[model samples]
Target: MTAPLSRRSLLGLVGAGAGAYLLGGCSGDDSSDDPDAPQTINWWHIQNTEPMLPVWAAMAEEYRGAHSNVTIEIQPLENEAFKAKLTTATQAGSPPDLFQSWGGGVLKQQLDAGLVKDLTDDVKPWVDGLLPASLQPYTIDGRIYGIPFDVGMVGFWYNKDLFSQAGITETPTTWAGVLDTVRKLKAAGTVPIALAGKDKWPVHNYWAYLAMRIGGLGALQQAAKDGNFDTPDFVAAGERLKELADLQPFQPGFLGAEYGSPDGQAAIMGNGGAAMELMGQWAPSMQASSSTSKKGIGDKLGFFTFPTVEGGKGNATDAFGGGNGFAVGKDAPAATIDFLKFLLTADNQRTSAKTGAVLPTVKEAVDAVTDANNKTVAETLASATGFQLYLDQAYPPAVGQQVNDSVAELVAGSKTPAQIVKDITQVAKSQ
Candidate 1:
């Protein structure tokens, strides 16, 4: 099977597929003439925990107060739960009026089924005010299908104190330097890294970054197109990952650690039990929530982009990450889109940024990022030369899941570098 359409190819197919449909067969009337007319918007988001949970509630309240005719029914669910619930709803031919979306393969599936609305015209007025890269994943076939609130990349979140203790003066810029840093940390009797092996996605990041560094962004796209990942470059990525794993750099019992649990990877770093972790922009907030003091490591933390591998084709500035956004259901009311627009205003985005929950997509609101670590991440993302969405979101579900599974096996030493690529190729071909 061929891979899912890339952002570029998908943009070419917009407007040629299906005509836009209004929610509940309602016309685009705002009901301003009839103040008594009621409009209810069903919203599903995965920010079930604080400080975002309350932040979202307040935003909705403010919107409702201004527009008495509109009532927003918000359902906040955990990340995995939201995915399962959304799947069931979409498959049943009913999705939330506006719900959380990552806007890649899954969004494409919904679009193919005519379950989501094309928001090109709805968001065009202010879409340009947001970072272009932040909109990449949401813009399909030259049409806007979602609106991004947060955008960031995956990188190393390290403890400055630990690095200083290890006697390292600078962050590593190459794979060899990374290994050397790990050795230094080990020599100083500290955990070099924190990993949540129980969550396969975190482990997959290492392999994904390695693949991009060794083979370049085109390599992944070409492999996906050809349904073959068992190439020399792919194997080399796995081998490089193995080299790191062989050093036994991760914290004790990392093979069984969870991602956001009390003793998970984030917690380890937050509690200062480990020196570093490779994670996305939300890492700091997660660390804070999971830490014993509920304050994380604070200013002790520093962000650095993923290092390059010598002889690699990828540039060091190439980013690998994704962000959160909202997808409007095909039958969503006109007011639903309006509420979405309200949520993305510079003022509202800045409000969200102040909570340290998001790296605002609106260019003007980026200055509201008060957390120093998050600011560094945002600036790095702003200057990135290239970007690749998370592999699980970039590819079809089957292929993405298989990538995670195979990479986890490689990390566990149950599969060889070559075998990992072979297994992934098998899954991709079957899809």
Candidate 2:
């Protein structure tokens, strides 16, 4: 189970044991030697809804117009659909020329199967121009396999009016303060938080962030390396989450709710049913769409980084989140890489950001994040001292599923904090 890596190597230990399940694809010679040679590139992404959908279509159209000899075939699928389709394609030794990638253990798996291109040389000189933190998740084994168009972090997305109603003038900056704020918000008759226990992945975030804040990034890597998560700091994080759980701060039936259902976490936040939710950068748009009004809180929405843990080794700058990017397939033509670069340009990044659906990975495009909530996410990412991909995406499938299961039980009051840690350790050791 032990693996050697560099830099953010401590993160995204995916598919270390699944190598036997993957088959190698044929080495591609479909690429053209002439830069302007006529070719068709297959592009796949998972932005299937409005705002982003039309935006991508326009970008492809623009690219086609610029390169008259090039024909672009674009396919936009929903998130789950894309994953299923990609799994089928890669298993058959065929994948789109360029497709979406989240760049953690998943990227590691793709690389292991020789399904991805090594972009280190192709993107060099210019890749360094992107933000340092934004590049962390995409880099594996000291090489770049993908390019990030957006980068983000997880934090508290709150409603200004609800906070004001609860007499919370400022967002909590420490764990203790957050506990107090939740107490106040609950006392004021507002559901302090919204959670989706049915979707165990979201339940994992609280435990993950608390552990990062208390144990620091090294502690996580150390556990991952040694297959031991039964430590004081990890237990202490679960204890703190238990403290909040004891307050009964979440909306009723939270244990059964889904992430995007009518009564889900985002809907509760959008309809002002809950005071806040701990979510990623896409929280705002999802909330708006899922809300009954389709016009979420609008200006009433705000965001703040996860609170610091008092006396903890980590600070607010250590972030926990992942973002979207494009990875070149092994069979992709050289022109496919060029198209990816064109899509990530600063000017083009600005266009994507203006849709209020993305936060640019390129430093020059940060200014395009004019929405107040989005700007906060971008600023927080800009100052990140450390990063960890989402636990589900960062670890092997069996281990990640175990993490989600253990966390969900803890949230549901079925497992003790200590028991949860031991459960995770057992799964990691088995892996």
Candidate 3:
């Protein structure tokens, strides 16, 4: 039940948990007049914020300072738009020198299409130092291809204040316990959980966790990759989600809520409108970004592995998450490769951790995380007994999209488990 140290981890988490991707230069051509001077390394990422932006900018600046000849240009893009644009750009052979990518089938698609550079030799030193599971997804056909900059997982982020108010002393670790807590919280006039289904991908997180909890990692992977959506295991997992929904567990109108919004699902938990949230470690930053949003947010935000169902094949410690990092494009210039190595150094990894991105890949850098919450995240991932790449990311691109739409339909109460399975089975068959 050890976390699958397979090639799916890197791709699964990013596509499932975050809705962004690094594409080609959105402006137009590379436009570097230095045909023989120095390579202009282009980086596409979505963390274009105050502190996050400054950190990446500094890394770029410092990288340029050291390399002297190379210039790193970071272009930020809107999440959904970037993914679409990147897909188009990559197809047209205009991919950036090195761009950010989510792990799993997303990266695999590019790998299958020969759009990304194979970095087996380049990543040897880092690979030797990484935990096996962490390195699995970035590698293909025995060659490493990408570097993990930052990685994190999704779990139950709970408001301790809300829990105490509901007379709940222990964090729930089983399906029954989760139900009990929801009932108690409701009696106390608080919604038990907050979930944002509007973005669709966030909804897939719950489905993946529940499927892993019920069927185990290997089964989920097989079903996801093969489109075996009709299995009893998948149906059982869908039922668990419905169980939570039946309890009136989610915040009011959560189905239509915004995702990645500080005031969305996390906001519901932050304001005491809900007792807990099924969200990633990034929830804190969103919660703390605004003055009003900071009301009940605290170090007391307790976390627990997604609860398990009795007799489920998946173990309690098996969690869902992955990493996103830069990989050289197939047509990258030699100078760009040199610049990329500079960005992957231990020092830069440490700087990225300080930006609130959880669990950086560098051994030395992640070891230096002083924040208790960050430390907990590192421990949780390390201690996990089993893991699965997020379902959508683990499957083919077409299947991934179908899974997202299926889960969204299930959550919206428009599709039954049987119908969803049949629908996805067709998608899987087509692939």
Question: What digit string (tens of lDDT, one per residue) describes model 3 on residues 1-431?
Answer: 00111111221112212333322222323445454455566677655433355576676777666655565667765344456678798889778777766556677889888888888876665566655676665767677777766666777788888899889999987988888999999999987888766667767777778888888897776875566779988888888887777777777778887544555664666565667876665655544542254434777677787888898998888878766667778877666766666766778777767755445777778766766776787799888887666566567777777877887888888998778777888998898
| Candidate 1 residue lDDT tens string, 1-431 | 00001110110100111222222222234435354467777888766655677788888888878877777778776555566688899999999899888777778888988999999997888889988888888888888899988887788999999999999889999999999999999999999999878667788888989999999999988986888999999999999999999999999888898776789887899899999888887788878877899899898999888999999998889998878888999877767888888999999999989878688999999889998888888888878888888787777777877887898899999999999899999988986
Q: What are the RMSDs of all candidates, in order? A: 6.9, 6.6, 4.8
Better of 1 and 3 by lDDT: 1
Candidate 1 residues lying further than 4 Å off, grouped into runs, are 1-36
Candidate 3: where is the Cα deviation over 4 Å? 1-36, 270-272, 290-296
Count of clashes, each model:
4, 0, 7
**TM-score to true structure, per model:** 0.90, 0.86, 0.88
Give the Cα-based TM-score of candidate 2 against the true structure.
Answer: 0.86
Q: Kindly give the stretch of ten consecutive residues in candidate 3 with the minimal lDDT sum.
A: 1-10
lDDT of 2 by residue, 1-431 (tens): 00101000111111111111111122233567776666778888766554576687788878877876677777766444466688899888787898877777777878888999999999996897687766776799789988987777778999999999999999999999999999999889999999877767777888888999999988888876777889999998899889989999999999988666678877889898999888788778767767889778899999988999988987679988877788899988778888898988899999988877687888888888888888888777767888877776677655766877898898889999999999999988986
Worst 10 contiguous positions by lDDT, candidate 1: 1-10
Give Cα-based local distance difference scores for all models. 0.80, 0.77, 0.67
Q: Pick the TM-score winner.
A: 1
How displaced is residue 313 in candidate 2, in Å? 2.6
